[model samples]
Target: MAKKVVPEAERRRRRPTRTGTVLSEGIIVDTALRMLREHGSGGLTARRLGAALGADPSTLYRYFAGMDDLTRAIGDELMGRALAGWRPTGDWRTDLRSLGLAVHASYLAHPQAAVLTASRVTGRPREIAVDETILGILRGAGLSDPAAVHAYHAFIDQSLAFAALDAGSLALTDEARAVDEEMWQSTYALLPAETHPHIAATAHLLARRMPHSAYPAVLEMLLDHVATRIGGGGGGEETPHG
Candidate 1:
């Protein structure tokens, strides 16, 4: 319940807190991300944020409409980090793969924050830039407008979906995580061969692979399909090794 609510546009004159640290959107989002990492999403409270910023809790509305607004901005901050200093190499498949990996890596680095943000639609600067850049990459590769849009949808959603999934696992407690990792080898591997022949057959492989992310391999398969669509096997036929 912020008092004297000031919308984003009206908060032009930055005021220093009692600690003399000026409050800006960047600082607020950075602090929020730290809080999200330290205390989880449920721990982000106005009183806590106010203490972190050395400012009054009611002053938050001067920059954002509410906590939800701040959350979106924090999500976009991850997006910004994902593409920070990223430049396209003009090769669509190569660039797309790099972008996908970059996004995945950023989320992995901030697992707790990623869990809260991976499914959000920020519509902020970084989110828009990443989408626009992906679209540009597809179109530059000669994908027709409709095809580019379709591919862009699949590409972005796939990245975020896997990010959310993997990040959720990463956010778990260490003991909990180890339990899940072991279950594939322990439970799945030990299934009787008579009734579960398929599992028994591939159980060893599953044990070796299930603990790792499926993102990189699945990304390659998707790119291979995209290459086929690019005609004459031009895009990623060789699967460019980094």
Candidate 2:
């Protein structure tokens, strides 16, 4: 006897419901990420996400305890993307430069999300792994435990701080961004020559510099400071010097 074959649509309709427990957390996070990228932090409420996903808001609770929990998960997702396939090259400067640029690029790609979540310390697995990688880099550079820890703190803090700040600045609407440019060109550029001689001298250069132009240079300056402190040149013999 020939067995009846279910139609594809019928099969889909009759398929057993996904155990909520095993439902794709990744999908949830991805949706949240998209919401963040499109709407900024304020637009990421559970109800909106639920509507977007065709799931009840309560369904989100099964995956995350609350919006804060979900936000942290989103942060972890971003970190995972930033660090994916990242392997240290054993050159501290190059490794750090790569890491900083990767992070900045990742955050810039999701500026609203970055602005919302950059300061959060979720201690999620991926975040912990990033911290470990950074600490290892500093330690491999021959920094003492205390110095390595300090440098790790400074490096991570500065990276995230700048990434968030830069992302926020980039997220401004075209009109708002144009206004900022206008202020710099018209108002800031016109500072009194005698009272703000240094500012006056660099106003044109500053106005011409795009936001991205300074990130690499800023990262280099920070790394240079870290290297100086690690190389025994900054303070005393305990410090490392280039």
Candidate 3:
């Protein structure tokens, strides 16, 4: 795959699409992202991407070896967006919280693409940079090497896991998603108090609130746990917003 790296001059010469549109990695990734949003994961095909770019399907091969490569590239693009202009404020917990939210927001913004790419290990520039940044933050917070590694694993995994789950719900069709929401309102919210007391009591609140993503709350919990373990007191309280 991507056997040879073409020189910049050659790449520039081949940049023009069949319709005289200029093509580059950014254009292809952006088009793919739009396709994923408009048409869902199934709608993103090489043929469709080519058509959207007004280029021959084969033209995409110059940039991406195949669809999977393109998918990983899209994932990396999300990571890049999340980390863009984000700087750690030297307070480890605050920085970690900010990082989690940024990553979560990026995925939620493109649910369809998130569903395809969240769990993947892209190892691309942005993905690797994110991993390094998380580890650095954890270690900077006074976690020993082993402990920092453990926390890094937990934090990153939890973030991506929740992103994928929430994105799956967002990617549901209008009819299907409505059914889920209706179930929360009509079925769960109206359960008999005699058998399911908790559901009956909190049903109103649950219906009102459960639609939001739980990633932010979960991330806060993880961060709090890690902070507590390392005796990182007075790290500023964080109110998680999903």
Go through the candidates in order and give each one's C-alpha lDDT: 0.84, 0.77, 0.85
The C-alpha TM-scores of every prediction are 0.90, 0.83, 0.88
Per-residue lDDT over 117-181 for candidate 2, one digit per residue giving the tens place of the 0 to 100 score: 89999788988888888888888887777777767777788788888888888889988978887
> Which is superior by TM-score, 1 or 3?
1
- What RMSD does model 1 have? 5.0
Q: Who is ahead in lDDT, 1 or 2? A: 1
Q: Candidate 1: where is the Cα deviation over 4 Å?
A: 1-15, 232-242
User: How far is 50's C-alpha from truth in model 1 (Å)?
Assistant: 1.3
lDDT of 3 at 131: 92
Q: Which has the greatest TM-score?
A: 1
Considering every candidate listed, which one attains the maximal lDDT?
A: 3
- Cα deviation at 107, candidate 3, in Å, is 0.7
- Candidate 1 lDDT over 62-114, as tens digits, reads 88878888888988988889899577887889999999999988888888889
lDDT of 1 at 61: 80
Ranking by lDDT: 3, 1, 2
List the lowest-lDDT window of 10 residues for candidate 3: 233-242
